[model samples]
Target: MTEMATIMDCPPPGWEPLVEELARRVSPATVIHCHEPLAKRTTLRVGGPAEVYVEPASEADLAEVVKFVAERAVDLFVLGRGSNLLVRDGGIRGVVICLAHPSFSMVEITGERMRCGAGAKLKLVAVEAKRAGLSGVEFLEGIPGSVGGALRMNAGAMGAWSFAVVESVRIMDYAGRIHERPVAEVPVEYRACPLLKNHIALGAVFKCNATTREEVAQRMNSFSVKRWDSQPAAPSAGCSFKNPATIPAGRLVQELGLKGHRVGGAMVSLEHGNFIVNDGCATAKDVLDLMTLIQARAKTERGIELHPEVEIVGVD
Candidate 1:
């Protein structure tokens, strides 16, 4: 078989033509894997395959894929480091684009400023900033996703939100148009960035005050210790429920005696009530079922409705 054939072969059912066309459209350096299993891509380690998975070589290459998907009107999902996400059992129907290329993971620091690419892991950003003696980003050390995902969700950890450190973000809209916006002009809430709801976050520029490297390291270490003590070590999509303003989600779960609840191989972590962990052999269905039980129990028994904090994607 030809090299191209290997990359484009055996697409799930009707996905072959689309994958073939997409492979032809993007640059040769761009990686396209048809019928790629997504379980390995996600932190939860559950879910089926993506009909087409793409890793673009550059921003131009990513624009090509986005343009193609927009023209085709097929569903498009952008994958970061795949934390805080759950892909359903039947898999994603259309194309899933991952910004895993080196072009999208670069992190550079100049004095007290840091510029990060979308695919750069949150942990890496913190480490780099810490190395540069920047203090504000130490909170990001405990977040488990990529900068793009963090921007999208306004992800918070240790009382600091992603946008709090961001001076501006470079975004690519679904129409394949790229633009940069300052944080003051962008709208963000507790856990949502409205500007990124339909657009892609390519990267951001972070402005932080100068601090001693020793201080940054000390802060990161304290946050890490607290996270390890509070959160579970098992494979999970992070927090499963958004804390209602009236109370913290974990506290509510604990109060409701739902911390150790299990359904199939999916269990609410005894370590953190807000997390649902896969018991090695758990399926996406198991996780979803357990999540539903938690929500229902929270609503019926406690008079509070729990909503998912993790992004649930793809078909059931």
Candidate 2:
């Protein structure tokens, strides 16, 4: 609570009025008390308590919360499913907004397109697409994390990335302005995108061609087997490093003899070098050190720069 005690106790000029402002606009049930472990909310199941966590019931409530932070000049974080996040032992400051409400979890399939809110899980997207006889999203069947996080990280596997099927997206800015933009308007790179600043994604429309439901399920089954064989299913961020254009990060780490390397309680997965898993008990610093080790080894051996795919948030 050092972060909160230092910044939130006395009420700074720009952030002090947040509580009253947010309360005026939303129901009390949406707000959670202090000391709730955020680790339970994430796939990794690690980290400290959130000083204040708010789960708005609807999009209107979400908009009001965003506006409240803006009016008070306080910082706000938009969280999806928390699947790929690494929250530090020190809790986050200001407000953390969870957008997994039913209103933000809608999914609609029309023609060959699927429109899904940011909170929708990737697994759900794959299942819905399969039921609708869509072929493209089958590759994402085993990918854990929300659609928003997938778009943010350009999450991909089985020769397809999330952006490959995205037709357009809706975003909400810090000041509560909403904009709908086509895929062409947002530039995408390998595991990165031009949609990195200002706005938070609200939902997206993905264009998928038609296929038989059985074919889609079969494709998804193949992906699931691959994931189960290669990844540590315990508690981990999906992949620790982004693959280079030509070589997979896992392959590079294995080539450098860095697989199974350990730091504190974190170790590079022996099965998949691109993953760092908590063997027993691990701190954020343990994971950080392991990442650096693999990066340095790969650079010295193959001359390729390694970039993190996992989103590292909060204090180090």
Candidate 3:
């Protein structure tokens, strides 16, 4: 994680009251700042700032903060590691809760099942599962997001998805009530978990098959090599578009001659047509414009509608 600079003492205008009230209600859990720049929080390293940034110490504290924000009718966004997200220049309006606290990042294994916190990185979860001699999540080793983000998006790689191994998920509602639902109960589809769109995932339980640790590690290493070979080395939010039913998004973009295309500091990655990389000074608008160009060209030339896989949030 990149170190954040010193936080400003003064809150952003019009958010002073909200910040003060939040500080009182959500004590112990640090309320970092108002108008905190979001670039460092995301993998792409682009984006403006968050209205009110918060880091809850524990699940209970997170719940309290959520309930407080909900009752006051403030818009809330639960940010994970920001691997597959793009926050616009105008920034997020209300509270931005980040589940980076240690309490929300615990990982445990028991009897062929592993439980991981929402804040736990996908790579860490994969390593933990391998340590326990579990298989089936080797694909997660290459994904660049947190477990919660992965679950929310039904994140997949190398023919494996989050829901395929999910046994159950612990989620917290807008009112701060927690519930456990089986995988069957959650409406998980390709690249989406609609049930978790509004609620926040706390942790997930995955059922894995018993396997040799060496075998799991080998599979994981294979996946890592494949990802490194295909994906860009520059900062990016992974694939910009989801693969349509008929064709892979990357292949389609390549066919459309969109590879190496640039809009401002954002460019279509030469290594992978599906990725839009930040060449140090890219902004959210640049990425969005590049996406629009790709979508337009694909639709006009190939009659294929390209849909973004990366979540676009905040005002523009």
Candidate 4:
């Protein structure tokens, strides 16, 4: 049977007891669910459930969750708006904490600096910057996902990266201890911030320049138009592969004659070769199979090694 037709909806074995234990430990306001379906939470809209999904109501609640996971050596996944992600069919094994409560999504401006809670939406940050007559984050308006994801990925668009505007970041370690570090102290390398992988992003402060609202609007509009013209409107986990230094990944896919290529319900978008879109009935395996096909073709036909840009997680 196809993966989509045969996938089970059960939480992992022992998840019930673990969830019961966790529920007793966390704040009452914290939203918790057992065997929470994660498909709807992602941009691709195709994945299994999180064995135990949680949305902490406050920083203290988040810390408590982290502490509980650490003490038991439980696997933990931090979900941030689920943009560039692909969860496998079996679902996650342990805890999935989403920092999406009101306290984590607040935004504040002070002089030339802006503080954004990790859960704050990128689009919202851009809008706030524009409201404050700022210019640095206009590029962020085009990117989907939260500040935490942007910080973790160092997300960039329109010639600017997430770290380029970052002044400092506040992070909580696995042990639930919080620390503040300057951007200079936090090392980042192309679409990755390694520290955030092991730590939870609480918030970040960004540096921006004073600018007229009209100028910011113009730039944002230009970027929006370009993105709309170039990207697909279908459901995708953004770009499938990272751009090779010599050529963009999309152009490479086209060069390989794989644009609009299909493997079951997953297809390379004709609008953008780098995007593998779900055609209403795609499963995680379909997308993965299509990726393998693309990789094989690119390697044999063009001697190119295409690596995925989207983060693939969960079990097989």
Among these predictions, the greatest TM-score belongs to: 1
lDDT string for model 3 (1-316, tens) is 3332223466777767766666666545455677888999999998888888888877777887898898889899989899999889888888898888888898999989999999999999998989989999999998889999999989998989999999999999998999999988998889899988799999999999999999999999988999999999899999999899999999999999989999999999999999999999999999999999999999999899998999999998
For candidate 1, which ten residues in a row score worst on lDDT?
Answer: 1-10
Model 2 C-alpha RMSD vs. true structure (Å) is: 4.8
Clashing residue pairs in candidate 4 (N, C-alpha, C atoms within 3 angstroms): none
C-alpha lDDT values of all predictions = 0.89, 0.78, 0.89, 0.90
Candidate 4 displacement at residue 235 in angstroms: 0.6
- 2 versus 4: better TM-score goes to: 4
Q: Give the TM-score of candidate 4.
A: 0.95
* Local error of candidate 4 at residue 268 (angstroms): 0.5
Tens-place lDDT per residue, model 2, 1-316, is: 1112112233324534455456557754455344446777777666775655677766666778788878766667666677778878775666788777777788899999999998899899999999998989887788888888788878788889989999999988776678899999999887766574567788899999998999988888988898789888667887888789879889988888888889988888888988888765887778888888888877888889998888877765
The better-scoring model by TM-score among 1 and 3 is 1
Better of 1 and 2 by TM-score: 1
Error of model 1, residue 312, in angstroms: 1.0
Q: Estimate each model's TM-score.
A: 0.96, 0.88, 0.95, 0.95
Clashing pairs in 3: none
Model 2 regions lying over 4 Å from their true place? 1-17, 33-35, 300-303
How many steric overlaps are in each model, in order? Answer: 0, 0, 0, 0
lDDT of 4 by residue, 1-316 (tens): 2111111244457665666666666667788877888888899988898888889888887888899899888889999999999999887878899988888998999987999999999999999999888989998997889999999999999789999999999999998889999999999999999999999999999999998999989989999999999999999999999998888999999988988888888999999989999998999999999999999998898888999999999998
| Deviation in Å, model 2, residue 275 alpha carbon | 0.3
Name the candidate that leads on lDDT.
4
